[model samples]
Target: MKSDIRVCASWREHHDRPVYTLTATCPACGGDAVNSAPAPYDPTDRYGEYRRALKRRARQ
Candidate 1:
């Protein structure tokens, strides 16, 4: 399931550490917020290239 938790995009101006929140906007600075969760896929996945190629072929 997707996470509802997010972090302020402009956290540097508001606090020394990352600020976590459940809302789309930050409560402190009213700035934009982004998902705090790590990416689900591995960066070095060996099969990723093949998967992408298959997707492109299907599209064409």
Candidate 2:
């Protein structure tokens, strides 16, 4: 299951530090919250092209 943790999207404007919460809105500022985790894949992955090619081949 996805984690319940989230961070305020406008944390910089609302607080001196990031505001983490389990809800969809920041407790302090009532602003929208976003998942705090890093993306599952790296954008600079060297083998990403090869992986995409493999998936494309499998699709056909």
Candidate 3:
């Protein structure tokens, strides 16, 4: 059977360093999970195609 996807973000404190997290999961199966986010796509650097797509979205 198909399962719905879940996404989560988490972080740890008690330190001076900065940290970030992203996660994806399938709730139908407790252990089924994945990381579905891109590796930090900077909107400012993507000056051609994706940027136009983003700008079009902003106008809407």
User: Against the unseen true structure, what C-alpha lDDT does each candidate score?
Assistant: 0.91, 0.93, 0.43
> Model 2: runs farther than 4 Å from truth?
42-44, 47-60
Residue range 12-31, candidate 2, lDDT tens digits: 88799999999999999999
Query: TM-score for every candidate vs. truth?
Result: 0.62, 0.64, 0.23
Deviation (Å) of 3 in candidate 3: 21
TM-score of 2: 0.64
Please report the TM-score between candidate 3 and the true structure: 0.23
* lDDT for each residue of candidate 1 in 4-33, tens digit (9 for 90 to 100): 999999898887889899999998889999
| Candidate 3 structure quality by residue, lDDT tens digits, 1-60 | 223333332212222332322335333333334453445655668466877899999999
The lDDT leader among the candidates is 2
Maximum-TM-score candidate: 2
Candidate 1 residues lying further than 4 Å off, grouped into runs, are 42-44, 47-60
